[model samples]
Target chain A: MANKLVAHMRLPQPISNLLAARNIQTAKDALSIPEFDLMTLLGVDIEDVRDALARISKVASPPYQTALSLLEERLINDASSGRLPTFLKGLDAVLGGGIPFGVLTELVGPSGIGKTQFCLKLSLIAALPMSYGGLDGRVVYIDTESKFSSRRMIEMGRNSFPEIFYSEGMAQEMAGRIIVLHLTSLSEITESLQQMKLRFLQHEVKLLIIDSMAAFVSGDNERSGSMSRDHLLNCPFSFLKSIAEFSCIPIVVTNQVRGHNNDGTSQYSFLGKDTDNNSEKFMNQVPALGIQWAHAVTIRLIFEAHSGQKFIKVAKSPISPPLAFPFTVCSSGIALLSDDGIEMLGQEINVIRSQGFFSIFDAS
Target chain B: MEVSALPISPTNKEKLISAGYTNLASLVIVSPIRLSRELQISVQEASNIIKVTLQCSGAVGLDGRHVVLRGAQTAWEMFSDEQNLKHISTGSEDFDGILGGGIHCGEVTEVGGVPGIGKTQLGIQLGVNVQIPIVYGGLGSKAIYIDTEGSFMPERAYQIAEACIMDTLESFRFHRKGAEDCHERMQPNYFLANILYFRICSYTEQIAVINNLNKIVVEQKDVKIVIIDSISFHFRQDFEDMALRTRVLKELSQTLMKLAKKFTLAVVVMNQVTTKRTDGSFQLTLALGDTWSHSCTNRVILHWDGNDRRAYVEKSPSLPQASASFSVTGKGIRNAISHSKRVRMM
Candidate 1:
């Protein structure tokens, strides 16, 4: 193997003559020789030895796949695959039946607005069999925040599928099918995504979810202080896009929101001072990963919290309008809001406010 | 014992022993460049000596005993052993008492506050305090100060060192005779020499310094304190992509924590503050938000209470929620005056 690897390296004649004289027939043998020994034996400069090692390594590694091959592979796979239903009626309607396969769907929202809950619900939904309104496949839920909870999944599963949950060992078996990887860094996430390509080929994984992509990448642009941040970000996004497209797996990524201002008015104006204007000013809440990241996603869903209720707005979708609706997260998971539920929510807010339940608000 | 016991040639062994490679442990830690230069040997021979010394030191054991996985019993024993734990003092008695002695080694302590509130002062004070000789109530160790915000003042450090030297000399005068003869050892230059300062202008430099810190600490064996004055300075601005920033910050903190644990050093990181609007009002919070709040083992917040500088222990494992009043004077951080004195002056 070492000899074959060295045969691929086209070194200068002088270097080859030195190698032949020293009986170094292989790259491995040459590398195993100390730098000082190599220099002394070859009667060459240290730079020449370094160059030889570099050339050996370059030949040893295989070349990357071409773009034409990637495109051919994508075409060979089914490109017009169907969407995976999110199991929320209003959300499914806004997302045109559900999140589409062979594309990247970004879920952006602020903290405590059920972005994670929605992803968790999707993970369970993807794991369900087709007979019970699911894609009937496994899920790769890459949790960056260490917030992936199997206990919560069990609670949601018990609510969604009582018959399967109450059955002996069924719920545990179903939950086992969904793979959760807790990655703490961007590089680790990139490596895991690369490795998951092989895992996806072996397993029946239909969905790939990175719960809160912003949790890892946030605040790095200033630290790097170079233009390479966009390049560094492009690798994972492009890899995810290619993997989703080639394998026809739906990729759901969650992102955090930062405060944005348009025309001198705060977009997330929950202050109630501009009640009439605030409802129409939903475009100012920018996603965390800048415009470059925004352009990478096929669809962008923005989740917001307003008046003790959660709202999912289609911020930027290729097929849908700027539509939104209220939803509530219960022990059963995210459910669409009803007319009576909205009235009850209003009364609950009034009751809490009148009773001074949030005394910190008053003190502040 | 014979020098021939080493793997080198007889002539080379004599040279190595003459160059102070008499012991295996010392040979294991010495750099190859120093060995080669001192002994006038080839770099290859020096590297071979280092390799042999490392193997003999049980660092890379052939029997795999060096990599044994200990059970919870060993962990519990290590946790309960008080002598094994060491702390670097913050130089102020009140601050040290608030910290339950001082900042313990093998833990990351974050000091956060609004601008001009003495976070850097405390960092410099700790850098100076780390050099206090073990006989004078200190760890007698060096410090690696990685300054991101350029707040590390050498003049201030010299003043603190001078005050510390004076304090040590006064104690020696009371405890022993011929204290004046020890003036050279008590010089501020000696204290300043123990601090390795690295001024990082960008986050990339910060990461590079941190990634190579283990190597630096190993080369400088006495480095027991790592200070990054204002870890959040470069991170708070120009970060259009929050996700990338968070990832970098998380990775950097993890590396710092690993260095702290593996090298048994006190990692002190300084952070800035942002006014977070909660409940229709502004409240001062750490710059990196909730994601980074849990990264540090201990968090101390410096704030102003009238004319005095007050420190609050926002988070700690062994210490309770506590507050102490300390002021950063020209001579460095010191305990504030008593309330009785203030009342009398008023």
Candidate 2:
């Protein structure tokens, strides 16, 4: 809609001819300003350019009225639906009463830091009714790697609520609530996501999970010497962002790590090439995706493993500090460390409620 | 907070005396006695009753003795000061040598790798081997396996266990022993106790499985090994919002760390990887991000060199970083797959 407006500015025919000579397509394209790079080719910097563009970007009078009606409808739906909630026993202290219904929470990690375990347990929790640390809704998982297992889910679920895992009926019931889609390519995900709203409503889905968002670009698309590959790979992420916004359903994306060269020596070294050198030096040699990818994520949690255990650090979160917490991946599920496993697990809800991770959100 | 400060009663004082509190010092040492003493007494009376009043706050350690006056106020203070950390044993002597004995009770460690690279195998190996007592370089508890990938082979666990216990078993009178018997016998000696109490299960029964595990650890007071085959399976399947995904991850990690600490157990985690492609090239990396990277105390990546297995010391909090190559042989985790050369990290 914003791109459609053409009321910005008019350039002289001679200037347009010059822009054409320079291979510029549209008047808007000719604007060479950083904000409007293609414009400079037309040799036009008319005084009213910026204001005219702004005016065109604004919704027209009729569109504004229509937009107001749509906003009203959305607000009403949001209020009435009481969207699914996330239950973090101690995290409410930082998150202010679970994760809000419509936002992304990126659970980042090195390999084996229990990120996937944490994700699995959350799916089980989301299946339970609201009172039992769940949102009582269906969940959809988009597995880029085809690693979803019902047996494991049942195993983890059995102890949390035996009936949910043991009862044969539960398989069907859970199948209805938890959906897993396996895709090998990013195009499939993007195409499917474009129709997510209809599918979600049809499936009664409340949660949408992308096992590794980066894989949609990183894995499915082949990396080559062509610049077009980079743009094509990035297209899926843009579409994912839009999907999350349009559906008002929280989207979770897992990302793979790229070796960073902390030092300048191997800045251009391809993946895994610098392992022969001092790993620390090799890591110092590479860099991450700058600020572009960072700006897209609202929350980012970095997971690491120490001595075969998992720890979570809030690398970037809009609501919490960057504190690291220890974790365990046990038969039950992922859990925060407690003073006493005996006194706290299953025996004391009030005590569990008092922990930092479980405390009531001190919302401002 | 105001009502929390109070005094003791004469009857409570008598109980303290009966519990072996000879003087004010003894009374302070056994703080719970103060609560007993002040049961029905007014705050003023209890406050004025003791010879010297001092506020005892923070963690305390006892002499490892069971004092009858464990109920005393002073003892409570002493309890607050005590810091006890539990640890899990890794089978590798070199790895354990670097890890300051093993995975500590309250710390989180992460193990990462691409699928088919032996992440689960390592975790399973730890489960079978972490059964020796702490003094003997073990935690002496049965292991709990949370298999997320459905690749948790009970047969493999049995194989690992049999290998670990190869030299410990006495010749059986019954020559009828078969694979089932080996499996039954290969299990850690305490397996029965753990099962009788812990009810170790899989991720599908995650909640009940954990509750039983907690029961085993807390009630039996001996469990020490927990293995979650692949932590990513369920979480990746559920939770749409990244923030909520993290919160949930935090909750689970926190719970496990607390349990490991409280019960003196070792926890092992398995991870899955995602492949990243850029400009006609591809690289495989662990799914998830910085939250996971920093939360763990150790990180290891398992990769394959053709048919041979290679493991790297991606990160270890206190240990010097190193990588080793090994093969999945019939015997179990071996230093070398065969006569192949060992590549040591400098």
Candidate 3:
């Protein structure tokens, strides 16, 4: 195998001989031991140790891809057209037919306004037969909140696909196609995703749905370190992005929203910025995990609620407009509202702005 | 207890035992830096070995993250288990009532406020209150206090410990009337000594300390609470990259969340507030940006409301959006008035 690490290192003869004596065959083994220790244990010179360590840190990054090549690859890939549709007409229209494949889409909202219901309907759609407009592939749904209800999945199946749910055996087959994994801690979720890279190829999963991302991050546990967040978050989520892009699978993740005020003093972020996701007057609910998290996704949808009315906003998307769509959570699954228009939404925003709620930051 | 039980590579395993660490318990107290020196390996590699061994005594469950196909649980079992998880009191009745008990275990709770508005005081009080004997309606477990701003005063802790001990004794007296008994480890010195304090000087140290806390907890075995006096202190300065700060803070919070659940500890993080420029004025918002607001399971904002200190439960899954008045008295955290009712906001 050419002793991959040694071949890549370009180490001098004495240092390579020293590494051999110490049984340091791989680059990982060399990197795993401190440099000072390398000098004492291997009896190698400081200059050679520095050269080896520097080479390890500076030389080993993934090969860079050009924008043109990526664009060309996507253009010719037939699987790029595999966008599965949600049966709701209004949502399908706003989403430009359906949710696209190979993109990271977020469902952001407050607690319990049918974020899970949206995911359920999507899972059901993704698992449907190709004749019924689905991708005709399996789904991997990672549920961290332990709120994955098989009963609700069956209900959504019966509600959206009448013909498919005709028999108990059919339901069983559909259930088997959708593999639900219950994970609680953040470490567990990230580790499972790492292992799923292998299971993904075997299962031929077309859709990867993490019921909620913010839940596990804040809702679960792990260790700390000198390593920056850039290094930490980049591994799992960007790893996920690569997985989705490589296999042409659409990845869906749900996020929780936190209500905050618009104090322009804070640094502004252009990532996933929707000009009017929430006006300054409506308690200003933004997506959790901040602007840094916004950069990791390709699309962001906000499931908002106000004065008894429900709204699903296309807060961020590469191909969709910055607009809101009214929707309802039915017993079967999530459905769109009967009458939804840009004019009605504009009026609602105007009314919310006119009635000034007491901003309490002044209490300080 | 043997080094043979660690889920590490055989070569590393041989090096570990050769360095005089024959058992798992011996590795618990050995810092990663020392282990690296002793084993002639990198600190990262040393921590890896220690983490593998400390997670479990037997190799049967060494990969404790359990990403593998472990058995699943029903909602009923989760609910029953949650019901039995006890909370560490905030030392105030109204504060405890509005909090659904006190600080919840197996979750991260962030308390934010301007400087000197009792964030440190509340942090110290929780550190003391966690040591209240389990028989006296407390968790009775030790606390790990990571002080970033050097504001954690030992004198304040001693006073709080005194109050906690007195309260335990008083409860013991009341329960003795009911023909019940209490744990004898209720002395003031015992409570003070039980708190493990770490003073962090730099942002990297803060992260490194927290990253290494899992090893410390494995040795201690009874840490019920981990308090970061101010999680945002080091990240707020000299960092030109705003996006980098967000990712770092998010990752750190995720680590704290994982630690809390794995060990069933209440993680309380104190934060300082930054002023946000509003229309022709400035408003005080929690520091580290809006994204930092969602880093905790519950967000409590402490502020000065007409000279009365108030703690607002801004965000919680099970509690209402309410604020209650509490005081940092000479003893510890206590009710501001005889009847400081929960002020429900809409």
Task: Put down candidate 3 lDDT per residue, A1-364, tens digits, no spaces.
Answer: 1124654566777777778888887654554344566779887678878676555433332222222233344457658645768787766766656777766788877777778898888888888778888777799999988888889889888877888887658777777789899987667877887777776666478898987877744432221211243234534565566677656678899887654445442221211223333455455555554444554566677776664556776654433333556677777788777524342211122111111112222332
Candidates arranged by lDDT, highest first: 3, 1, 2
**What is the per-residue lDDT of model 3 for residues B1-346, given as tens digits with 9 covering 90 to 100?**
7888777988889998888888888888889999999889989999888777766754344244343335555556668878999988898988898899899999899998754456777888898898776666778788888876544545456667888788767667755552244344666667767777775545655655665677678888999999998887666643457876676677678878989989989999988765554455345577788898888999998865543567888889879988888866667788874423422112
lDDT of 2 by residue, B108-225 (tens): 5667664334565677667666564333334555555564333343334555666666633432324434434344544443332232211112222343244235544565566566
* Model 3 clashing residue pairs (backbone): A220-B257, A220-B258, A221-B257, A221-B258, A221-B259, A222-B258, A222-B259, A224-B211, A225-B207, A229-B248
Q: Taking the tens digit of each residue's C-alpha lDDT, what string does model 2 give over A42-160?
A: 44565334343233223211111111233234457752223344334555444435444445667655544466676777677767765555666788788886667777777778866
Arranged by TM-score with the best first, the candidates are: 3, 1, 2
lDDT of 1: 0.68
User: Per-residue lDDT for A131-198 in model 1, tens only?
Assistant: 98887788999998888888988999999889878899989878987899988888898888787787
The parts of candidate 2 lying over 4 Å away from their true place are A3-54, A60-88, A166-168, A200-203, A216-233, A265-291, A339-364, B1-346
lDDT of 2 at A218: 45
The TM-score of candidate 2 is 0.38
Q: Note the DockQ of each predicted structure.
A: 0.01, 0.01, 0.01
